[model samples]
Target: MMVCRVFAIFFGNCLCLLLLLSSLADANQANIDCLKTFKSQVEDPNGYLSTWDFGNQTAQGFICKFAGVTCWHDDENRVFSIKISGFGLRGVFPQGFKLCSDLTGLDLSRNNFSGPLPSNISFLQLQHNQFTGTLPPQLAQLRRLKTFSVADNRLEGPIPKFNSAIITSESFANNLNLCGKPLDNCKMTSTNSHSKVVILAALGGFTVTAFVVGIVLGFFCSTISVEQLLFRKSRQNR
Candidate 1:
């Protein structure tokens, strides 16, 4: 009876440990999926991402072999950051980056990535890319952002307002059409204000002209009536 009890307790402990390990494995697989999705989105011309292979069990530790990938820990296998500078990649900002919930920092400078920057990415360094379009206001949601930069890109339109102090002139240097605080104060959009002013000025000028014409007509009629009365008196005297 004692032996049976000991065996039962040992079996239960083993089962519990197995369950814990299984959950962690599942989490690691999800991280792998996130990376796979991101890799599919980008166009790596120089084969910089060539080592990203998921075929062999030995390659399961993708964070170690993949270029610019950093994991949370050696055993965890969860991505922490990606700093792929000068990869010569071409594509829109990777929207799939949000899949890596554990991600903290990203640096993708000196690439040909076009389109808008992803709002989901906060702590980013995207300098010297071919990115175009307006800055997304959703970037303000990154409350934990510490360092941000996007200098020397082909981005246009107004830079989104951020409540963080990470943004500065250096972050927005060489971006021709990008304007806002810390840059050029964005050439205050005065189209609507100018239109309203023009309309009011035109109305005032019309009112003044009407008043002057009315006064001139009134004076002319009064003089003609006075002359007519004088003429009638002269005829009666004759």
Candidate 2:
């Protein structure tokens, strides 16, 4: 009876451990699918992202071999970080980044990607890219963001407000049109209508002032003429 009880306990523990491993594997496979989808969207001019291969499921450790992809654990194989930089990859920022729910660090710098940054990421390094567009205001909601950088991009408009302690001017350098708290204040880009309004306002003020001044001067001269004429008439009557 004692031997039977010990065997049952050991078997139960093994079963529980297997269940846990199976769950982790499923989650990691979902993450791999996300990466595979992301790889499909980008244009790899230099064939840098061609290293992402998901063709053979029977092959072991295929997902782990992807360029710039880092897995959480050897046994679990969950995506933890991505570091793909300086490859001249060009495209709109990948939407599949959101699918990596457990992504901690990301570095896609020195590429030719042109678009807005992803909203959900925490740690990001997107420096030296040709990205154009305003910084998304939703980025402030990423409370987990600690390491952030978007330097040397073609981005414009006011820099989105972020935690000053985490982001700074160095992160925004060389972005010609970007401005805000961490950087210089954005010089309001004057539109044609705005310029016209300012000019019209100045002209209107000048015209009103000149009209009032002319009226006052004319009234003063007329009063002086009347006084002079009255004095002449009185002297002639005398």
Candidate 3:
């Protein structure tokens, strides 16, 4: 009958729609879980990230439009940036930040984050915070690390060495006890050894060069004197 056939088609379509929706929901929840890991790590004052709504049933909505979050063009479901600067969040680095694999920018400046930066995050823009600790060299491991700034913090010790052109001396300025290249008087511990080795090697080279020159000069003078004396004695005998 036509009526029976219509019901069957309608039910089948509904089932397919439910399954598709379920799959999307699962992926969204996974992304939320990743974001939730970083929630407790920071101190949110103005609650700029309050709208994150980690428990929301839909994950695509998060990437589509979330407070202080940005997503990539081709990947709407994947976060690419989190700019929460000047929001008065007081805390250390967030957790599971690396979970946002497509993240290209993270601006946590003007907060009260007080501690060493997260090692996995290389391109951080922490303009102002209460951060205090030695710049961890582990951050240097981020080969994609392009920009780093922790100005106006209590961070001290050597500014972590990075081989990237994106980092420069001024990036870590306004902090206390930071030292290394590009910044005058902030020599890093690693560079000191290199300088010492260079000085010692140069001194050793100079000493060797002088010894060789002296030996050559002495050999020529001694030979000339012996030859002259022998010639004079031969001439006198003749």
Candidate 1 at 58: error in angstroms? 8.0
Off by over 4 Å in 3: 1-30, 73-75, 186-238
For model 1, residues 1-238, the per-residue Cα lDDT tens digits are 9999999999999999999999878777777877788899999989999888776534446565688989988666688888999989999888778777778888988888888776667789999998877788888677898888889987777777778876888998998588888777667568967987899999999999999999999999999999999999999999
Pairs of residues clashing in candidate 1 = none
RMSD of each: 4.8, 6.0, 8.0
How many pairs of residues collide in each model? 0, 0, 5
Best first by TM-score, ranked: 1, 2, 3
Where model 2 places Cα greater than 4 Å from the true spot, the runs are 1-25, 58-61, 191-238
- Estimate the TM-score of every prediction: 0.77, 0.72, 0.62
- Candidate 3 C-alpha lDDT tens digits along 1-238: 9999999999999999999978755655555555676675666767777776756544345554667777664334666677877888876677678666667888888877786666667678987888888878888788877678887888888666677887876788888878876566655477888999999999999999999999999999999999999999999999
- Per-residue alpha-carbon lDDT of candidate 2 for residues 18-112, written as tens digits (9 for 90 to 100): 99988877777778777987888888888877778777754545667788988776544478888998888889888888778778999999988
